[model samples]
Target chain A: MERERICFTLNNSPVEIHCHPGERLVDVLREQLDLTGTKEGCGQGECGACTVLLDGRAVNSCLVLIGQVAERSVLTIEGLAAGGKLDPLQTAFVTEGAVQCGYCTPGMIISAKALLMEKQNPTEAEIKEAIAGNLCRCTGYIKIIKAVQTAASARLEG
Target chain B: MQDQVVGSSPVKVDAKDKATGATKYPGDLRVPGMLYGKLLYSPSAHAKIIGIGLADAWQVPGVRAVLTANDVPGHNGHGVIIPHQPVMARDLVRSVNDVLVAVAAETMAAAEEALRKVKIELVELPAVFDATAAMAEGAPLVHPEGNILSHHKIRRGDMAEGWARAAAVVENTYRTQMVDHAFLQTEAALAEIDDGGILVLHVATQYPHWDRKELSRALGMPEDMIRVVGGSVGGAFGGREDMSLQVQAALLAMHTGRPVKIVCTREESFHAHSKRHAMVMHYRTGATGEGRLTAVEATIIGDTGAYASWGTNVLRKAAVHATGPYIVPNVKVDAYAVYTNNPFAGAMRGFGAAQPAVAYEGQMDEVARVLGLHPFAVRWQNAMTEGCITATGQVLESGVGLRATMEKAGSLVGWDVSKING
Candidate 1:
């Protein structure tokens, strides 16, 4: 197995790291770049805990190999906030009590962010569909859905 | 005594860290000179171990050490109530998930690869998969003490007289399948010898103090020599209450004199951890024409699987709560925790009350139908009130709210307007 040097924009910063082609993008980000915010719930893509935005699209980093993300811009939960300010979705989640055990919070927020990016005001069904991949075992999806709706409404008002 | 913070929604202290991914779970931990550990589970469900060849595994590159049942310095068994389960299968493999070998190496891949080189010879034995079949006359014994792990019974008044006084009787059998906790994070543990020569294990578990005591017993070390620290658990719906990889990682770290980390894959988590006991319950209830409960008899059999984890306690709970919250003068309840070759059964959210609730509630509905009375009305008539004596001989001096709760539910659901039969 040979290690390949790859360059990519991580959390809006250009970085280069050597990784095995067989390694998963989630492993590369966590082990190599020290971006441990992205969790690997299920190594299989069934769980969306390892969700990261690649080229403005939400993707399961566990399913994506290191070679697949070769020069793409990746955005993780760590990158959602900037200048010591919480993202609207993060703030809404905190206020709405959507972060129960908090294991699924990062993935849920990332999915909600992608949804908000695509549509300013998504319907409840659309919001549910967007985050259907992420599973939160603690709080039954009601609180999470409410949090996303709150963030969407806040975005519309602001 | 409603305080400001009692009913108010306050943010969790760790919510920010967990949401920001700053909270480190056991799997995310790493130490300098750390070695990855992997275990080789038995392939056979029930078998006798003929021999295990570890020469090829020892020759694997980057393999630090290999351990089997022989390597356990002290007690080989660990269980919550009964210490019968082996840390590693000593002579016979009772279940498919029984661990046989553990390997430590530089990388997880190398450790897994080394596990592949280890060969184990097994002689297959007849396996019992059902609790009733396992308890029958000459079935295969899962344990030397026989298939019945623990049997609990509660006898109050005369069941025969109570049934004779009733006008209608309802009997049914209900069953529930085994359930996994399915917590977000799987089992993981990291162990290292600290500067003070104490083995410190950071693990995802429900009980850190219990893990320390069990680890001390398993490794034959003083309680002070072992320090168990529970990290921010991803989720533990009672599955993490039992020991999984805690002692194994500690043993490997002690053997190699380096930090050892072990994380269970989802499949491994399902195969290895304790699950909710599957229950088969038979219930027969006698009700008068007025819909008042006369007597109830329940026989519950819980499949505790390969080893008794919390079977004894669970069976007792099932027996005690078999009658639900109803006031029955003549009640007979028998609960048995039976062993089989299935996955080990232990604590879950409901403990053992969920299965019996289903049976008793279903019987209540049947009794209501037979007497041509509304379900809520029948339940309200028989619901325990203040000063009512329970089948276990406990008098309810206060907090008898079953009838009130049922009436409130009926009103909230518009039970009077809705079709009651459906």
Candidate 2:
């Protein structure tokens, strides 16, 4: 097994790592860098529980190999908040009662953040389309859609 | 007093940590010198094990150990109510998902590679898939005790006289298929020998104490030599109630003197755990022209599959709730939990009530059509009120609010008055 050294920007920090080229990015992030926030729900790309921002686009980290992440910027759930203040999306989710069991919360928030970053005011259908990949069994999508709408409005007011 | 926190919405205690990806589940656990374990399952639904060859698997680089049923140092049986299911297949495998072998190695890839090297020889046996066919005289017996696991019955007033008073009758059969829980997180467990030589297991299970007892018995270790702990679960809709990887991981860890972790893939999770029972139900109901109920009869057959994992309780509940919430003076219900070589059936959200409710409610709709009465009107007329006796002979002292619930539902949906008159 050969280890290749690759440099990449992670959570606004530059880092270099030597690891297997075919290793899953989710494994590298969790096992090597201690970034266990990016979960691996299905280990396949079907479930979006391992969603991470790869150069401003949401991608399933489990499907991305370490070699593919070289020279790219990656963002995860840990990097969503700045200066100890919770992200508005995170707060809105709590206020709107969108989270239950909370296993899918991080991935859902990441997907929602990716949507909000691209569009200022997404329609209800657009919001639904954005999160169609992430599955939450408890909330039934009513409170989640409401929370996304609330976050978009709060962003506009701010 | 006005409720302060009872009705008010409060944020869940684990919401923040989970949102920030800080909460750790059992799958996220990792310990020093930990080995990954991979299990081999039976491919045939029913088979007799001839022998297992493990010399090639032992030769694989980084492979620590390969274990089979013979390696289980204690009692090999494990089940919620009945000690019938084997931890590993010894001589016979009644289901396709029965564990055959387990391999522990330094890495997951090594463990999987070693698993492919292990050879298993099995003689295929004639399998019985249908519940009714399984109970037939000539069908293959899933268990030596015959195919019928248990039967429940509920009888009320004279069925003949009640049917004689009815103006119309409706009879039909309904069937439901097995459903998987499909939770976000699959089954996962980590086992390690602690400082005091006690095997500590962290798993995603509904019952940690029961897991400890089962693992202790299977490993031939004293209860005090094992400690089971549960972490934050992702989602468990009664699917995590059964044992998955707890005992296997503990055995591997104890044999190799290192931590062992096993995480089931989504495909393995579907084959490994218990599922909701598939039911076939027959319902017959007699009602008057004025939409009053006279008699009700139901027969429910539940295919409990290979093992009796809470099947008897499910059959009992199905029999008790066969007549629905209506007040039927004359009723007879029969429910049977039959064994087959299909997937094992166990606990789910509604247990057994959901299946019979579909049948009884569907019969109500048919009865309404036969009497030319509105659906809501027929249900409202026959709905049980306070002090009405149930089919099981239990008197409802209070809290019989079916009529009120129907009225509210009808109002919310805006029932058409003109259609009812027509």
DockQ of each: 0.70, 0.71
Model 2 spans > 4 angstroms off: B1-3, B416-422
CAPRI-wise, candidate 1 is medium
lDDT of 1 by residue, B1-422 (tens): 33686668877677777666677888888889999999888888899999999999999999998999999998998889987788899899898768899999998889989999998999999999999898899999999889999999999999999999999999999999999888888888999999999999999889999988889888999999988988888888878877898878988999999999998888888877898999999999999998888999999999999999998898899999999898999999989999999989999988998889999999999998988888877787788999999899999999888767776788798786235423
- Worst 10-residue stretch by lDDT in candidate 1 chain B? B413-422
lDDT of each candidate versus the true structure: 0.88, 0.88
lDDT tens per residue, model 2, A1-158: 79999999998889999998999999999888888778777888887888999998888999999999999999888888766678889888888888776777888889999999999999999999989988886644899899999999999999
Best by TM-score: 1
User: Interface RMSD (C-alpha) of each candidate?
Assistant: 1.2, 1.2
Candidate 1 wrong stretches, greater than 4 Å:
B1-3, B417-422
fnat, candidate 1? Answer: 0.53
lDDT tens per residue, model 2, B1-422: 34696778887777777778888888788888989998888888899999989999999999998999999999887889896888898999999668989889999889999989989899999999988788789899899889999989999999998899899999999999998887888888999999999999999889999999999989999999999989888888888888888888998998899999998988888877888889999888999888789999888999999998888998889899998888898999989999999978888888888889889889889998998888887877778888888898889999877877776777779986445534
